[model samples]
Target: MSTFDEKLKLFAVDLYKINAIKFGEYKTKVGLITPVYCDLRVIVSYPQLLNTLAELIIEYIKKMQTFDIVCGVPYTALPIATVVSVKNSIPMVMRRKEAKDYGTKKLIEGQFKEGDNCLIVEDVVTSGSSILETVKDLKNSGIKCSDAIVLLNREQGGEKLLSENGIKMHALLSLTQLMQFLKEANCVNESVVEKVKIYLQNTQVDPNVLIKNNRLKLSFLERLNFAKNPVTRRLLQVMCDKKTTLCVAADVTSTTDLLNLAEQTGPHICLFKTHIDIVEDFHPNFLKHLKEIAERHNFIIFEDRKFADIGNTVQLQYSKSMYQISSWANLVTAHSVMGKGILEGIQQSEGLKDRGVFLLAEASCAGSLTDQSYVDATLKLAKQYPDLITGIVCQNPLLLEEPGVIQLTPGVHLESVGDRLAQQYNSPETVVLEKGADVAVVGRAITKSADPAAEAVKYKEVLWAAYEKRIASQ
Candidate 1:
């Protein structure tokens, strides 16, 4: 009998020989473009490799627990489960991706009692969605499933997600192990290995960190892991590191006042929103100083330019005008009323590196024009430009159907009910905790306070406290 290492080496050799493991640009099920692809289904055509894989999985599972029946996830793992069951003399059950329309309508096939313990088998695990779906089905049928075994673990939060749901995960080979074997065997080049390593590091999602610091729901984190927008990710990272989801709306008119507000509130905010065009003393030096303060305090400059115009006009307004808003602002606001062309225009800006846009879905002012139809259209347009649109500026959180997009609630104040200008307000607890807002945009509450810096700290603490409470309740 060969050692586990010896068997794994031979299996890797066979995998490359049959072209089951290919090196190229392949998009994963979670929408990540990976450098290497592992098609486990190809193993079925090679009987020797299939048997070796079953042996490896059975050996790996031996350390876990003994179960009454083994259930394969679906189309791909059924054959592998059959091989494992026959060779080990273990009873096997099968789960249908979709039950038959007419006969019996049973989702699970084979003989199993209500209290039987079933082990889930899978070809590969990425986000563990398939395994979770299979577990849901088995649980509904009153069968116990406390363990799952997979041929390959992509190391992309699958283990953490499964463990959170009370199921232990066992894998025969992880992506790191396979990469190391391939590199040692000279099957893949150094560049391929490096690319895979980089991708894994960049895309790896830690549910614990996200929940602990960011206070984001697990379901939201799963989608956020696959988001293509770098700026969106950066915003979330800044919020976590700063421990604040407060965006201070600097509604002042002079550069001095704006810069003062920024300096005072910068340490307590993830974003310093501005209306640069509205600055009475706007100049090149103002932006330079503002950017310096932003970098010093680890906050992003958000230009609240609710651009609503044709593509050509907006493009010039964003990049070419005297303001040149794209040169410093990390994020900008836009109205989807103009349609996809607005996004295309923003994308055409020359200095638009690592920038994102938030679409105006609803307003907090009295008698605002943003209706349900307008919000639906805005979200629909935002979806078409996922890489550009990172969030929706709204009064409520209902517009957030996609977990990848965040919600920013404006007009948040601690005590003010309604301003003379018809600006309504909500408390930090109400917006961040009850409304599920990612960032509570507070304008007058912080900007108009006597001690702006002290006021900023108050709002930050309240917002973060509410966020922690919300996640704890969840």
Candidate 2:
């Protein structure tokens, strides 16, 4: 039997053919005339193919460790999620658009605890509005949606929207990947592939169009310039559209270890997050070295201080404090738990404009206190101070109502349970993909592994599988 990776490669090639064969002149839901159409609902008819597909997805999930539950959206995704759940011996949840008054009287029917983390699975994403709605329903029922996995992302605005709203999205096959697969399989001519590329290019040419309704629009290039303002660009570089890789703590005990890991996982991640309080040894020399490495590796350094104080105190922490956090760190994590005034203090500092600040809204740990009170308060604060708050770190996927607040989730682990000597988080690829996480904060699995490079490859493979599965479904 072929290894999962080989099978996945073959499957992507087959899926590309299926998509190309199915493609024809068609009108999209948005009324755009297109030369191709992808509806993965037909894949269910081929039991063997479907089974292999499910196995591929399960393989990625198992690699991350087992999850507590797998949840699928209404209509198409339910069957796929069901197969993965059954095959992996995990429970599954379903989110209905509206409450069913007849049978269950339920909108979200599953065996989930109020704070239980769930991975939301979907077939495909176009505009991402439907998934956001699903996330809202999941949160309303008191479930934590930290990650989302899909079959295909059309390289549309969905990824950005999901990321902006604080959900990390992973795809088994992205549009680009699928197109390449089609080219390799000879299913699509170069002209058709070029058309798809043009479609994506045109879509991204204007960020304003993507968020016109929300009145929030800034092209990635524009955002890059915005990030470069003398105040902001020095510490952080917003590499990807929405996701960020953050260094968790900056204490001397783990700084070197964390920086080393960040360098190894650079291209796969976006931001390097850190908490200054954890650093035991503070020195200008260390800062200089770390900054140099960050530049060399193409990642941003985030200071995850979770700052919650008055303006003067916050200013002191950023500028003249003992740690002098503003000197080297690019992004900062703060708690909106205090309100808008606290955010204003940090945003007003010199050389801080480009420095994105992630607000703590919903957090991932087992016993986080992000209840309804916190959600309401955070949403209110988010609206009042949108400019200062670059993103919100929340476990609740529904908390992504507003734009500009980049959602960064930590507590990301591939293994559900660490070996006998270590504790496990059981975060499967399915969970991460379904919940629509922006950037997953992974440590032990990558750092503690005998081969960090291999461990990183495992994550990239699993993530790629999730992306492909989503695309095939779409």
Candidate 3:
């Protein structure tokens, strides 16, 4: 390998020797399940090893970038910072996790004054919460900290979190690098390697540190088109006109009953969702009547096709399908796993500006595989085509509520009862009042009720009240 690789390997080997990297089934202090646990605190026990680690950190920081002062993130990073400051002749700041009332009563202990930029140095990172909080305190003190350097990145959400928050992080080695070095050294078995890989794949943000906003950031142009998108604009209009934030999910399997259901429920709903393929006897003629009813009733049709294929195939499926979905459906749902190409295919339709897609960002199941990676992918796609991605079908309202994108939630029930399947049900109030969802999609709650229209009205009342309360609270 080259010099850089050599140093990385050396650092990994050194970390292993210190028992800083342990192989076993253990839960991190932050509750991250992993086959390997990292605690660089062990380095301070051996004087020579501690100095070696400090030198490594110093070298890594110097090679990565420059800073006006070095700030250690409390207890674990203080020793390393001391050595780096003494060796490199750099100024340093120490931040205490809690300020002592008897002492200077200062949260920060250092000679560096306000306006001096600092490079945050940490031994290892899991969620980067401490770093973020420290950065917050540093900023509060008027000191600038724009970059951070960590010895080991657990491949967790920390690096991304810091970067998103405007602070860049440079790591000497990642979990993948260290794991590979250990495997090559014959320090871990095949099972250990597999466990670590699995853990890393399923690893999500620790709930406490998961950063999110109440809504999405919409561009001025997208915001202007917010009222132009037929589906979203109509929904907002329904909220304004009818004072409701509920969308009736008419998932019946018959075209005639589907039309009847839309006509019956349209007065109270802004959108009517359907699973077109499930309709027992579907035809192009069926859509002709459906569109007429939709126009007369002032509601949009959302085809829950969940198109999961490639671009060309999905485009054909959307445009040339027997039902002629592209011509009739106002909005369509697509899985984000297929990436942007799937949506790109649907966007290639004749009415590009008029149509939009709801990317399924979250699954309403008990133990779904969807995680931060999936949510991030969905957000990336939505941000790419803000106008086209009208909204997201997600349960995490805190992060998914972008300005123009509506939050379409499913598995809603008037009562707490759920189906025999794994699908979970949330109350309309829970989803809207608390979670910030713009629209609650009710299926059996409305369709199977004694009175579907009355049920629709009930959901509209609760959801609209919750929407008003949420807005008032905000």
Candidate 4:
């Protein structure tokens, strides 16, 4: 199979080639004249393309853990849903637009009976009213309807409406994404995208969530004052804003590799974390390029300095060093051994208020010195400097509930054991989901992949899925 992105782009391109999505005033099923119309019912003409659609829906069903049986909304989605159910051997069902008057004389079609989990599949969601009708029929039959899948979400309050009716709406693409792909492929221009945006903005159920991907990015100080920890807030905010919760730890020894990785995969990450002192042949030019990558990619620059000195000395190290860390980093890591004095010292630096710091609540080294007492004291110390502290580099999720304290767990890998030197490692699932870390800091696992960008994409999917499950449980 192709990469997830390639599949979506290809699906849309093939659909456009067939003139499935046409631009012109047309009457919708609901009786509204619209400038554009999507007729996915065209898939019936191409079995090969229809098979791909089934495979894509199956991919999402497996990833999302959505349904045991698939049901089509009795129109364009019927063929795809039928193909998916039969091909995958999943039970298929549907509520007809009208009850049959002939043999069987039934409103519901399919062998599925009552009390089965049904997933509603549809071509598009404009207002979500049609799917709700299917849900109503399913509920009448005592069958549960908990999820709906769509090829395209119109971004017209349909998702919010479905969610309100106790169904999770999963779409392969949204209007905003479709616009982006079209513009990138030169299929449409900026003016056309702007017009589509205007149409979508008027159909929002929650305008706040739709305005810029449901995020309100805060400045360093604003993040501090947030109800959650600044680091947690930052991580979640980035995930919501950029649709990813993966951060790359540029652990390479060469500045060349570091910049290349950032430039190539920057858009998929929430932050580019670096140990500036370790990069070979590092210079002001290195920092300049690194800063540029972060700016262009919309990710934060995190210097993993792990400062352990007294506040006064650490302050100088953060600012006056040959590298001049304070000039570029949006955040840094520090150890909390000296209590409030460590934070007080760092905060004393000029222009430091707009930057944030993550305390070393615990380390990943096996049997290292940071214990429960240390973590508790660190939490206490952090509260005293709420304005300056963002979160902690924690192995344990002890500080999660403390207001505004985000836990960022390191030592994550796709596969690996402890290093010969005694450093431990955990999978992204272990650290992000099991330990409740807001962000997963990964290094060689991704950077060393045969294809780093594809590897990063895989990590993002798993991490974001786990994050969604955690949020639902909460």
| Per-residue error (Å), model 1, residue 193 | 48
Each model's TM-score, in the order given?
A: 0.55, 0.51, 0.55, 0.52
Per-residue lDDT of candidate 3, residues 393-461 (tens digit): 887553433555688888788775556788778777767644447778889888877788888888888
lDDT of 2 by residue, 342-405 (tens): 7777777765335667777766554467776887788778666654556666544443333234
lDDT of each: 0.83, 0.63, 0.76, 0.75
Runs off by more than 4 Å, candidate 3: 1-230, 351-353, 398-401
lDDT of 2 at 217: 30
Per-residue lDDT over 1-474 for candidate 1, one digit per residue giving the tens place of the 0 to 100 score: 359977887788789879988888888765567778888888878898888888898887777778899999887899999999998888998887644323565778888899999989898888776787689778768899999998789898989888998888988789988888888888887888888888889887565543433324433344457556887888877888888989999999998999999999999999999988888878887789999999999999999999999999999999999999899998999998888888999997899588999999988887888878998899889888889987999866554335667789898888748779978787787676545688889888788899999999999999888887766644
Those runs of model 2 whose alpha carbons end farther than 4 Å from true positions after fitting are 1-259, 399-404, 418-428, 464-474
Off by over 4 Å in 4: 1-235, 351-353
Ranking by lDDT: 1, 3, 4, 2
User: Regarding lDDT, does 1 or 4 come out ahead?
Assistant: 1
Cα lDDT of model 1 overall?
Answer: 0.83
TM-score of the candidate numbered 2?
Answer: 0.51
In angstroms, the error of model 4 at 193 is 69
